[model samples]
Target: MRAHHLAAAVLVAALWGFNFVAIDVGLDSLPPLLFVALRFVLAALPVAVLAPVYGPPAPWRYIAAIGLSMGFLQFGVLFVGMDVGVPGGLASLVLQTQAFFTAIFGFLVFGERPRPRQIAGMAVAFTGIALLGLDLESIAATALGLTLVVAAAAGWAVSNLLMKAARPRNTLHLMCWISLIAPVPLLALSAAVDGPAAMATALRGVTLETLGILVYVALFTTLVGFGIWAYLLRVYTAATVAPFSLLVPVFGMSFSALLLDEPFTALKLAAAVLVIVGLALNIGLVPGRIVPQRSART
Candidate 1:
């Protein structure tokens, strides 16, 4: 990759990494489900104006499924996990487990055999997650939070399979369409779970900071990040652009420690090393046969 392209890839990773902090900030003001509903609502706005430029890449059913799985299920569970007890940095690391889940699903669904390294990588990464579970000193991290985040990772893995099957030509267009599909169900769920009164209150009491966080996540993180990512994928091979995503957790943990005062225990540091090493192995950075590589999504 060229210097500028490398910078752009790193920029996307930074935006996505800081997004966990943004979500953690937003959750202080709004309920989790409601925050997600509002996010999708704002994110879908571009689809209305840019409908001519970015057409739907798949059938409505496929788009809807992607929306529900990727947009709603993954994010909904993620926000709730963060809101409940998961620290932003820890959540980011745990979410990388999605790659392993994706590999597992690929094997089961498409009969794509996992290489030996992939299996070993999965073992190493899950061991890191197990270590994370044992770390009791990490601030605000809980068993329920860890489980929900892992489930969210599985949801993300499901969306990856759906994306592969759909074979969308334009990722940004598909993202926009899915943005449209996610808000309705999210809003309904917000009303159901968060309560209609809380939803009303949250909207009525929205602060500038909260709105800024929403805009950052919707416009910068989701749209701009993916837009640049799609461009990089077009210009370079997936293998070339994909590895930079491993930097996300690096940024995530650093930002959380600096901004959110999230302390990294010895166990947490060891776990981070294991997970990143496993991810490196899984993505073919450490050698072995390369399979169909998937780009990391936030």
Candidate 2:
């Protein structure tokens, strides 16, 4: 990768890394599912209006699958989990488990085999995750938060595979359209679960901070970060681009501790290291490169 693109990759990681805290802040004012619904709405509206869909319209079923799984369900659960207690730092680490799940899904669905190293990495990472599950710190680290985030991670893996299977000619465009599609169902879900009163309170309570977070997430993290990432993928091999993503958890942990005052426990540290190592081994596999087709999740 060119130095410029490498720098852009790092920037994307940072934007996404700190985004967990943004979710936490926004959820203070917004209900979880409602927050997610608004997020996708804000993310998609301008793009939907300004940009044409990435390719010919995708299959409705495929579009719905991506919209619901990736945009609504994954984020819906994630915001709820984080708001309940999942520390932003640890949440970032746990979500990276998507790397393992993605490989698993690819194997099961596409018959694509994970390299032996990746298998080993998955085992190591899961072992660390098990340690995390034994967490005595708080509910955030416990099943309440952990399970939901893990579910989100698994959803993300499925979303990526759907993209692969659909094989859209222009994935970036499909992503924009999926963003548009994902939010509506979530709005309906939020109205049912969060209740009309909760939604009313959230809207009434919206402050500058909440709006800032919403805009930051919609524009910076989802749009700008991904725009640069997609550009890098088009220009470079995945191997050249993917490992820099390991830095996301680093920034996430730092921002969580510094910004949110979350703990940096021994077990969490160990888990982070193990997960990073596992992801490194899995991502930077044989042949020293992955073709651009296997894009990293933003």
Candidate 3:
């Protein structure tokens, strides 16, 4: 990787690391599913309109699948998990499980197997997560929250595999599709659980802070951040682009403390170390030969 790509990778990690803060802020004024719906709707609209100019359009089905898997399932589960009290820092750590799930799914769905080193890395990471889970202070206090986030992580893994399988020619088109497809299920679910009234309240009382936050998520995080990252991946090897992503949780923890006032407990610190080590092992696997096609963009 060139120094420039490496720097861009770091920037990507930083933006995503603090994503938990954005998520928490957005959730303050929006129902989890509704928030997700709004997010995708906002993200999809511009990209869809500009697809012809910037890139080729993907088949409608591919776009729909991206939205369903990445937009709806992934964010829906994540928001609910956070709503249920998953700490942003811990949630950041746990969500990396999508990598493990991606490996598992690739093997099952596409007949790809992890190399020995990859498997070993996964085991070590899993052990660390187990230790985190056993921590009497954090995981024990928020079992339900942890469960929801883990489910979210698993959903992300499934989505990653599906995206890799589809392999849309235009990566931006793929993201656009996720944006387009995500709103349907999210809207339906939001209406069902929170009722129309809750959504109405969310919209009617939408403040500047709410709108600003939404725009930030829709533009910078989903559009610009993901767009740049995707372009870089195409320009470089996955190994070159992927390794830096391990920094997201580190940023997540720091931002959680700075913004959300979430504690950096001893247990969480240990879990963070374990998670990073696991991510290193996972990404450091023989890159070119055992390319992991399945990876979550966010």
> How do the residues 1-298 of candidate 2 rate in per-residue lDDT, one tens digit apiece?
5467667888999999999888877777888888888888887766546465344346767877988888765787788888776888888889999999999999999899999999999998888788898864742466788888888899889899888777765666666778888888888888898788889988998999899999998789887888888777776667777887889989988898999888888888888889988887888644436544433432
Q: Write one digit per residue (lDDT tens) for candidate 3, span 244-294.
A: 778888888888889888877888788778777888888884545654443
Error of 1 at 159 (Å): 0.7
Question: Against the correct fold, how does model 1 do in TM-score?
Answer: 0.94
Clash count for candidate 2 is 2
Off by over 4 Å in 3: 51-56, 139-141, 285-298
**Model 1: per-residue Cα lDDT over 1-298, one tens digit each:** 5688779999999998999889888999999988988888888898887678757878888999999997676999999988888999989889998999999999999999999999999999999999888865564598888899999999999999999999987888788889998888888998889889989998999999999999999999999998999998887778878888899999998899899999888888999999999999898884455543334542
Colliding pairs, model 2: 54-173, 85-140
Model 1 scores worst on lDDT over the 10 consecutive residues at: 289-298
What local lDDT does model 3 show for residue 82?
Answer: 85
10 residues in a row with least lDDT, candidate 2: 289-298
CA RMSD of all predictions? 3.5, 3.6, 4.2
Best-performing candidate as measured by TM-score = 1
Per-candidate Cα lDDT values, in order, are 0.88, 0.81, 0.79
